[model samples]
Target: MKLLLVVSNYPYEGHPYSGAFNERSALALRRLGHEVEVLAPRPYVPRGLSRLASRWSSYASIPEHETRAEIAVYRPAYAQLPLLGGALWSESCAYAVSAGEIARRHRRAPYDAILSFGLIGAGGIGWRLGRRLAVPAAGWATGNDVRVAPRSSFGKAVRRSLEKIDLVFYQSAELRACGAALLNVAPDEMDARRHAVLPRGVEEPPVLSSERRHELRRAVGLGEEQVVVLYLGRIAAPKGVFELAQAMARARERCPELICWMVGAKRGFDDSAKLARCGSVRLIDACAHEQIWDYFAAADIFAFPSHGEGMPNSLLEAMSTGLPAVAYAIPPIEEIDQGSGALLRVAPGDVHGLADALVSLARTPERRAALGRNGRARVYAAFLSADRMASAARRVAQLIETRGVSFSQFADRSAAAVRR
Candidate 1:
């Protein structure tokens, strides 16, 4: 099958971590013997305005086309205003600007199906294109689109998009319910045939010997005796970086040898000054996805106090590396844990509780080892990339086969229902 994946976020030049999960899925689909291509509409900012800010500069720098993991990725430029509900209209802007190009490509060689990530943004593009091309379209609902976007100024866009796309894949069951609520429908109304969970997969890491682990720690500037707690994600407020800084300070009061390393890009929420006050926290710039395993290998524990998530790849990667996790007890996190006791859960925004959880994991070697074992087992047993992707490929095939026959009729009914 030939598939077109439309997503707003995708790894681009100098920003490899961006949209990494979406790339992984495309690669996985390709590995399943399907021809996969990506349409990632980058936010366009002119060269002069780009010079004024790093954010705009990055957008201006994106190449029109690039190949990642042997898949062709086309990045068309779209006008992206940074203010006044620009985010809510990004999908419409992208579709409006790039639809002709997409139609031209379809005329040359048609796509079998279209898959979109981020329901309100990319999903709109996919739904519009799928209708024009008369192909099956599936949308993926990640955390922000369901939880955060629905509460924003253009929140209704999410419900409208969800209603248009019949097949929606969620990162977790909790996220599915959240999306269902946004649609003003009971969770059960999101029938199994229409909605399902398709989580991101973590590749299992090779076990490191004690000597190699020590070498990795020293390479990252950590001492042999220090208990390392690593946080991997965007250094933004919603990701709980500020709370992490405070929690690290409190944890250090009890265990001075506890060292926290926060890795990844610094976003709008700059916590560098706050982290400096913490003293024991080390802030590392985002590195290639390939290099992250070294940090996972060196860490004694993984800390993810993120306020919200749709199956965090970092937490899963850390667990796959046999590292214990201490995280905020959000619904998605709890759904991932599934009562396995593989994680030490703390209340949302509770700095002291976060500190205690960190201390508890840092001081107890036995508990850490046990949790690590459980986490590793859980991830390998159920969350391997190959397994998850294989399941997703099968579902996509089913959707294409079924939806192709009745999409026009379904569209008519959906339009009538919405009008009524």
Candidate 2:
């Protein structure tokens, strides 16, 4: 089947770390013998505006089109309004731009279905484009689209999109429940039939021998006795970056050999001042996605104290590299844990608990080794297996072939039947 993925964030030349999972999904679908293409709308800002903000300049620099990882990615320019943060107006502009490009492609060789990576921008764009092109469309909710966006000013818009989308794929069951709640439907209702829980998978990393790990640690300026705790993601409050920093500071007092390495883009949230003050905490800027595995190999523990998540790719990647994780006991993380002891869990915002967990893992080498092995096994069995992506692709193909009406339309018909 031929499919078009409408995504707001996609890895580009300059921002290779952005949307790494989306890239992986597209590649996986292609490997399953499906023709997949990506349409990611790049924000367009005038040169004058670009001069004012380096962010805008970076956006302006993205080429109109590029083939990333051997997959065709079309990036059309969409005007970005200042302070709008890609809200309704930005989405409208993106839709207008993407619809035209997709229409041309559809005329040449029609796509089977359109899939959006998230709801706010890409989902709406995909639904609208699918309607205009007479194709089925589905939405994949990755965290914020369900939990955060619905409570913001985009609530009604999101509900409307949720109703109109043919199917909704959530990264976790908890996120699926959140999406159902947004639509005001019970778990066993029409929402259940129209939605699925499909977690993203991580590619297996090269096996790191003890010698290789020790070499990597030495390359990164780590002593043989030092313990490394790694965090890779955006440096933001919601990601618990500040909390991780504070926890590291507290943990170091107990385990003097402990070192914390926070590697990610600051984006808008700058925790440099806070992280700088914390001794033994190293803030490394985000690097290429391919280079991330080395950091995981050199680290003994992965710390992700995020406040919320929809199946984090970093956590999966870390675990895939045989790194035991320490994260908050949020619903998504708990779902991943499933009492498997694959990761050590702490209460959300419990800096002391987080610190203690880190210290305990640092002090107990045998427990760390056991948890790392368990984490790697869990990741492979649950997420890295080929069956996961193949099943997802088969479901998408089924949706394309069988699902024609939107979820809301089906719900309305069911309601009328009950009334009759």
Candidate 3:
């Protein structure tokens, strides 16, 4: 089938780490023998007054372009001025304009289906464009859309759009619950038959021999005997970086040989000073996505004390590489089960509990090794393989073909049925 994949945040040459999950899904679709195209709305600041507003805020402009990846890509330009107390009126306007462009293009070459990522402006834009082109459109929701946006007016608009899409692809049960709550629909009315839990898959990394592992360790300045706990991703607050630092500090008191290597860029949250103060923690600025496997192989264990997430790709990648994980036992994470790794009950701000878990894991090498092996086995059997995700996508597409109505229409009907 011919498909159009839409998203605002896609990885370009300039930003290779951006929107990796969506890229993985699109690649998976292509592997399943479907012709796919990408439409990314490039957000930019407007000229003059809008540029000033963007300098102050960053919602004043949008840009557009086209590229070829594993599939054809289109990046439409639009204005996104942040005004009226940080509203996204420019984003809405950009979507309307881009949707018109997409419609015009589709008239020349029609697509069988439209798949969108994000629940806010991007999903809404995809829905509008699909309607104009008379094609089935599905939206994939991650953590921010469900967990972060609900507190804002933009979130309300996104919720309405969620109720209007053809299908909803949620990565976790928590996200599904958030959608149901936002739409004021019953939990059961969320339509699990149409909605699917499809986490992105990780490619099999090159097998790292013991020599390669040791070489990588030396290159990264980690000693052979040190028990390295690795954290790979953006160093942000919701990621629990500060909590991980506090945990490492406590663990160091017990296991002096333990080392924590944080390999990611600093973006959302600031914890550099806190981590620096800890003698055992080492922060590596950021590595290429392709080079992530080396870090995973060099580490003894993976530590992700995240407070919020939607099936973090980092954890899956670590597990695929046979690294044991010690993470906060949140809902999306709870899906990891106990066999793969140790899931500790560390609430968002519970630094003490996080510290204790790290300390416990640091002292038990046998437990760590066992968990690591189990995690690898679990990833291979359940999550890392792309076949399951492709099957789920196919099922969602088939549901749209059979139902004759969009996912949002079905959700609305389901909501009404619940009320009756």
- What TM-score quantifies how close candidate 1 is to the native fold? 0.91
Give per-model TM-scores.
0.91, 0.91, 0.86
Computed on alpha carbons, the lDDT of every model, listed in order, comes to 0.81, 0.81, 0.71
Between candidates 2 and 3, which one is better according to lDDT? 2
**Whole-model lDDT, candidate 3?**
0.71
Measured by TM-score, how close is model 2 to the native structure?
0.91
Per-residue lDDT of candidate 1, residues 1-420 (tens digit): 999999988987678878888887787778778899999888876566666667777787788899987888888888765664545457788887767777677767878889998876798888887776667888888778888556665577777778777588898888888988887788998788878988867665776677878888777677877899999988777899888889998989999999888998554335555555556678888878888888888889999999888888889989998899989999878887889987788999999999998888887899999999998888888788778878877887887787747586556644343233
Q: Tens-digit lDDT track for model 3 on 354-396?
A: 7776777777878777877877787787676366557656765
lDDT of 2 by residue, 319-400 (tens): 9888989999999888888988888999999999999999999999999989988898889888873556787677777876
List the lowest-lDDT window of 10 residues for candidate 1: 411-420
Q: How far is candidate 1 from the true structure (C-alpha RMSD, Å)?
A: 4.0
How close to the true structure is residue 116 of candidate 2, measured as C-alpha lDDT? 88
RMSD after CA superposition, every candidate: 4.0, 5.2, 5.7
